[model samples]
Target: MRIVVLGAGESGSGAAVLAKVKGFEVFVSDMSAIKDKYKELLAKYDISWEENQHTKELILNADEVIKSPGIPNTAPIIRELEELGTPIISEIEFAGRYTNATMVCITGSNGKTTTTSLIYHIFQSAGLNVGLAGNIGRSLALQVAEENHDYYVIELSSFQLDNMYNFRANIAVLMNITPDHLDRYDHNMQNYVDAKFRITQNQTPEDAFIFWNDDPIIKRELDKHGIQAHLYPFAAMKEQGAIAYVEDNEVVINEPIAFNMEQEKLALTGTHNLYNSLAAGLSANLAGITKEDIRKALSDFKGVEHRLEKVARVRGIEFINDSKATNVNSCWYALQSMPTKTVLIVGGTDKGNDYTEIADLVREKCRGLVFLGVDNSKLHTFFDSFGLPIVDVKSMKDAVAEAYKMAEKGDTVLLSPCCASFDLFKNYEDRGNQFKEYVRKL
Candidate 1:
């Protein structure tokens, strides 16, 4: 079968390699220049690929297409495929067909990365053969091709979940659904929510579906979507059916064998991280990991990069890099964790963000605001009347410098941007790395 892979980055190249390994004719095309690392990897496999252009003649003849999660469905080629009735699937979906391994899939507007990483650490530390893939480590397709493991812990974005069909998660986790990437979902909250709910699409009664029990959206959606999978709901405090909950300052998992750990001793702290730890704990316990092993892993896990990473203390001022908080709810979590007044660095490609979610937090915790993006008009429109001193800058360097100048000795300079970073940076990692490099100099 002739398989065409679109957007030859990590996802596309991996899918191409996997298709080749499976003895299929695979062609990779990226409209932008492919990275040298991916180019080399593709060449090493003796697979054919093209960069800086997508040849319609080459792509349209595909038996199927594996699309990179970064590419939207509105892309001309994707639209063409839809019109032709040609099946297009995500790299995750294609990879799932070739592996019978247990899939522990995670998705949400926030906390998926940290939760995915924590669960992976638990499983790996418990002496289980596991591969970290999807949105975190290597692409699932590449891992499926080159390695054999009994389980894969995957982090799914709504974009990755969109093209997925027939891919069932042995264990599915929806951290919490908020208004995120609405720009890609026709600026509709329901559309984005529907895309996230796709994580549970193909599950059966034997499969497990984990979620935040307290999320109003999840609660509302649960009433509408009839899920066959066994429900494992978690929350900060115990409710009617929360399988995992906090009690007397102890994190507790009731089912899959009772488990508890001191909440204060958890390596990750903060209200948001409490939920992350709860989800990870439940996932670990369900995998038959010993309670002691789960506890140790949870206590020692350092945390994910760019999601509230500490940069440095400059002249008694703390600089935090939270570039991974790419939505209003994420920034709310970041600000909610602040111990002192903050000079908030926020702004980017507006993803139809409603700043009101973090408005109260901004008023309470932020001493000033740094608008760091190509366009800060939307940020200005909402935050302008908040009466905080606002500074606008296009580059991370200037943004950091201005934020530093505004911050006092005890205040924090937090780069908790609540929108996509495409306007002034490559991606969140690039934005975070730059924030750290510039911060270290101060």
Candidate 2:
């Protein structure tokens, strides 16, 4: 079979490697320059690849196409492939075909990285042979091709779930659905919601589906979808028959195996993290992890980078790097966790963000706002009535400096953009790293 992999990034390169290992004639193509590491991997495997342009003839002749999640369905090439009746799938979908491992897949607009990492940590601590893949770790296809394990904890995005058809998770976790990445979904909330629901599409009675029961969107949609997996609903409020819930300041898991832990004992704080901890604990219990192991993992997990990560304190001002907070909902979580007044560094590629979600939090928690992006007009217009000091900056260093100037003793400087990082940084990680580097110089 002829397989064409698009984008030549981590996912695309990994898919090409897996396709080659499965005896498929593989070709990798990327319209942008392929990274040096990926190019070396393709060369080591003797796979043919091209960068900076796509040869339509080569791509059109493929028997199958594995697309990177970053590629939109509206791309001309994708539309052409669709019109030609060629099957295009995500790398996850392609990798699932070759692995019989138990898949623990997670999807949501927020907290996916934290939840995926927490679950993987729990399983690893329990001595389970697990591969951490998807959005948080190495590519799923790469792991399946080389270091195949008995289980995989995968963090999926809506884009990935869109192309997945026959792939089903042994354990599927839907954290919550918020308005996110709507541009790719034709500005339709239901479309994005439907895409997230795909995580449980091919499950059976033996599989388990864990989700946030309190999210009105999930609650309203759950009854409409005919999911075959056993439902495990988690919430901050105690429900009569919930699989997981908070009771008397303790988090309780009632299904598969009963376990309870003081809410304060969880390493992650804030209401958002409470939901994350509950979901991770429920997943661990469903996977047969011991209650003792789950408690230990939940308490000791260091949390994902760039999400409420504390940087060094400079002259008593706390600095937090929440560069992963790329949406208003994520920013709201960050702000909600602030114990002190904050000098918020925000702004980036807008992504059609609705600032109203975080408006109350901003007005209450933030003493000032430092805008960091190519343009700050939208932010200025939205925050004009906040009556707080606002500064506009074009670089991470400038933003950090402005935040420090606005911050005082007992104040916190938080870098939670509430927008995509493409305007000023290569990605969220880069934005976060630079924030730390600049904070250290203070």
Candidate 3:
């Protein structure tokens, strides 16, 4: 069968390679230029591919299509495929069909990257033969084609979850749902919520569903959706039906294995991280990792790069790089963790964010604001009247310099954009690296 993969980025190229290895007639098409590295890999695999255009005549003949998560169904090519009733699936879904590896899938609006990394770290420390895939590590399709592992820990975004139908996770983790990527869902909150809920689809009673019990969004959604998986709810405080909870200054778990650790001993700090630790601990425990292994790994595991990564402190001022905070909710968490007044650098490609969510936090914690993006009118409209020291900067260099000038001793210079970095930089990693590089020079 002819399997056409759309958007030959990391996931799409990996999917194309996997399809080729499986003896399918594989083709890759990208509207934009395919990276040189990927082009070489595709050619090495002897896979037929195209770039700079999506030829309908070639794409229309596909028996199935593997779509990159970045490509929306609203794209003309995808719409045409839909009109033809052609089956389209995500790389994760297509890879799932070929592997029976135990899947520990994670999804949430915020904290997923850190949590996913934490879980993988714990598993690795325990000496389990595992592979980290999905949004963070290597592509799941690529790993499935090349590597052999007993387990795979994947970070699933709502976009990846959208096209997934029959793929089942042995242990599915829904960290917490929040308003994210609403633009792709026609600006309807429920549509986005439904897309996230897809992570739990096809899960049976034998499977495990872990989530934050305190998240009102997750709670409300749970009431509406009937999840077949054995629910393992986690929370900050002990709830009625919670399996993992903090009590007496300790993280405790009641089911799937009784485990407890001093909360203060966790390597990751702050309330959000406590929740992350609990979720990671529960997931690791459920994966049959010993308590000693889980405890050691949880305390020793370092954090994710772009999410709340700390930069150098020059001239008694701390600079934090939270470039992974692409939404208002994520910024709220970053600001909440600040122990001192912050000169917050924010703005990029706005995703219909409601700044009101972090308005109070900004007022309380931020000494000043530096808007960094090509456009800043929306940020100005919401924050201009707040009477805080605000600066509009189209470039990261100006944003950092202005923030450093505005900061005083014991104050923080935080680069939490709260919007995508596509406007100025390549991606979040580039945005974060630039912030670090510029801050280092100060």
Candidate 4:
């Protein structure tokens, strides 16, 4: 079968390689320039690809198409493919069909990477033959083709979940649903919520569906669309028969067996990470991993880069790189974890962000603000009433130094850009690395 892969980025290139390995006639098309590494991979596999354009005739004639999660449904090429009645599937869906690995997929507006990484660490520490795939580690398709593992832990985004029809996880985790990537969903919260719910679409009674019971969005959706998988709800507040709950400062996971851990002993801090720890711990227990294994993984697992990553402690002023906090909710979580007053370095590509959600947090925790983006009008307008010291910086170094100057001993300089990082840096990782480098130099 002729398979056309759209967007020659990480996901598309990986899909093309897997399709070729499966003896499918694979062709990759990207409107933008393909990266050198991906181009080399396609050439090594003898996969035909077109970079500056998408040949409509060639792509439309394919038996199936694998779309990168980054490509929106509104893209003209995608819409055209849809109009032709062609089957367009995500890389995850394509890879799922080729492997019988038990899939443990996690998705959320925030904390997904941390939770997914934590779960993978737990499974790996337990000596399970597991591969970390999806949005973080390696390409799922690439890993499936090259390194065969018995289990796969995937971090699914709503975008990746959109085109997947038959892809079902044996164990599914929905960390919490929040208003994110709504710009791609026609700015409709329900549309995004529905897309997140797709993670559990094909789950059966034998499958387990774990989610946050405290999030109103997830709770409302759960009430609206009944889940088929055995429900395991994790919560911070009062919960009865909740598969996972915090009581007396201990996380209780009552499942096939019962397990408890002191919440304060978890390496990851904050109420948000506590919930994350609980969700991951519950999954580990359900998967038959020992409580000791879970505890070791939870305590030793360092944390995902760019999310509350400590850079340096220069003269007692703590510098935290939370460049992955791309939304107000993520920034709120970061701020909530701050033990000291913060000189917040925030700003980047605005994704229709609602700063109002974090206004009170900023007012309380932030001593000053360093806006690091091209335009700071929205931030200025929103924060005018707070009368906090606000400055603008065009680069990450300036943002860090400016914040450092403003922060006193025992103050925290947090680079939790509550917006996307495309305005000033290549991406969040680049932004975070730069921040760390500058902090180390201080």
Candidate 5:
């Protein structure tokens, strides 16, 4: 069989290599120029590929196509592929068909990476042979091609979930869904929520669905579409029969098995992370991981890059790089986690943001606001009524320095841009690395 892979980036290139390893005739094509590193890999594998253009003649002859999550379904080429009755699937779906491993898929607007990592840490601590892939590290296709594992902990984005149809998750986690990437969903909240809900699309009664019980959006959706999987809801407040709940300072998970621990001792704090920890704990319990291992992993897991990461304490000023908080909801969580007065460095490529959701939190926690994007007019218009000190800066370094100057000794400099980094940086990682580099210069 012949396979065509679209978008010659990490996901696409990984898919091409895996297809070749599986003895399929693989051809890769990208509308944009392919990087030298990936080009070299294609050469090493003796796979055929082209960059800067897409040849319909070659792509149409394929048995199937593996598309990168970054490419939207509305692209002309994709539409053409669809018109031709070609089956195009995501890297995650393509990879899943090749493995019998128990899949633990995590998806939501925010906290997905942290929860996926926490679950992976718990399983690893239990000495389980598990592979971490999808959105975080290596592509799932590449991992499924080279290594054999008993389980996989995958971080699923809405884009990735869009192309997945028949893939089933033995354990599925839905963190709180909020308005994120609405542009891809025609600026509709239900459309975006439906994309996140796709993680549970193919699950059965035997599978487990873990969710945040406190998120009203999730509850509303659950009421609309009753799930077939066993429901496990985790919440900060007490719930009558929830599998996971917090009482006083301790978190308790009942049902299939009972496990309880102190909330204050959790490695990740804040109400947002409390939900993340709860989701992870419930997933670990379902996997038969011992409570001791879960407790150790939850207490010792450091964190992922660019998401509420503590950079350094220079001159008694704490600098935090939360560049992964790309959407307004993510920034709200970051702001909610701050303990002292914050010099908030926000603003980037706006994704139809509703800043009003975090307006009250800003009024309560922020000392000064630093807008770090090309355009700050919308932000100014929104927060002007709040009557806070706001400064507009052109670069990350300027923003950091300005924030540092405005901040007191006990204050925090938070680089939690509640928007995409495409305006000034390649991606969130570049934005986060620049923030860390600027902070280290202090």
Candidate 6:
């Protein structure tokens, strides 16, 4: 079989290696320059590849193509491939064909990374042979090619889900759906929601689907689709028969095995994280992990970095890097978790964000606002009437400096840009590392 993998980044490079190991003729092509690390991997595997441009002849001749999630269907080359009747699938889809591991896939607009990590921790604590892959750790394809595990906890984004057709999750987790990456969905909320719902696709009755029961959007769409998987609804409030819920300051899980833990015992706090913890607990339970192990893992698991990570406490002021809060809803969660007066660092590449969702939270928690992006006009116009002091900074260093100046000794400085990092940094990780670097310099 001839396999052409597009985008020689983490996912593509890994997929190419897996294909080669599986005895397929493999080629990797990336329009942008391939990172040196991935270039080395391709050569190490003796796989053919091209960078900086897509060779039409080489790519079109493939029997199947594994596409990276970053490349949208709107690309002309992708459109041409569709017209040529070539089958294209995501790396996850291609990798799924080679693994017999029980797939525990998590997807949603927010809290996916946290939930994925938490579930992996729970499985590990239970002494299960598990691999962490997808959007969080090593690429799934690479892990499938190199490691042997009984299960995989994958973090799936909507873009990754779009190209996944036959891959089925033994246990699927859907964190609450919100307006995110609407531009990629053609500015349609339903389109984005539909993409997220694809996580449950191809599942049978034996499979389990865990989701937020309180989200109005999720509830509204549940009636429209007939899902075969067993439903496990989790909520902050107590439900009569919910698989997971908060009751009397404790999170309780009732199905598969009855378990409860003190709410304060959770390593991750905040309303959003409560839901995340519940989803992870339920997934662990469904996987047959003991209740005691789940509780222990939940209490000790450190949270994902760049998602409200506490960087340092300088001069009695706390610095938090929440650069992964790249959407408005994520920023809302970060703001909701702040217990003290906050000097908020926000702004980046806007994705038609509606800031009104966080307006009330901002008014109540924020002492001042610092705009850290290429343009801050939209933020300025929106918050102008609020009568709060707002400052604009052109770089991460200046933003951290300005925020520190505005913050009082008892206040918190948060770098939770409610937008993408493409405007100023390479990615959210880069934006977050720079924030921590600048904050430590103080």
Top model number, lDDT: 6
Any runs in candidate 2 off by more than 4 Å, and if so which? none
- Candidate 5: residue pairs that collide: none
Show model 3 residue runs off by greater than 4 Å: none
Q: What is the TM-score of candidate 2?
A: 0.99
Each prediction's TM-score versus the true structure: 0.99, 0.99, 0.99, 0.97, 0.97, 0.98
After best superposition, candidate 3 residue 201: deviation in angstroms? Answer: 0.5
Off by over 4 Å in 4: none
Q: In each prediction, how many residue pairs overlap at the backbone (N, C-alpha, C within less than 3 A)?
A: 0, 0, 0, 0, 0, 0
Where is model 6 more than 4 Å wrong at Cα? none
Between 3 and 4, whose TM-score is larger?
Answer: 3
lDDT of 4: 0.90
lDDT of 6 by residue, 1-442 (tens): 8999999888999999999999999999999999999989999999988988999999999899999999999998899999999999999999999999999999999999999999999999899999998998899999999998999999999999999999999999999998899889999999999999999899999999999998889999986768899999999988755779998998988898899989999998889999999999999999999889998999999999999999999999999999999999999999999999999999999988999999999999999999998989999989978888899999999999999999999999999889999999999999999999999999
**How do the residues 203-254 of candidate 5 rate in per-residue lDDT, one tens digit apiece?**
8999999998878898888966667899988888887557798887898888
* lDDT values for all models: 0.93, 0.93, 0.92, 0.90, 0.91, 0.94
Task: Output the lDDT of residue 338, model 4.
Answer: 94
RMSD of 4: 1.3
Q: Spell out the clash pairs found in candidate 1.
A: none
Q: Rank the candidates by TM-score, best first.
A: 3, 1, 2, 6, 4, 5
Compute the lDDT of residue 21 as modeled in candidate 5: 92
Lowest summed lDDT across 10 adjacent residues in model 3 is found at 174-183
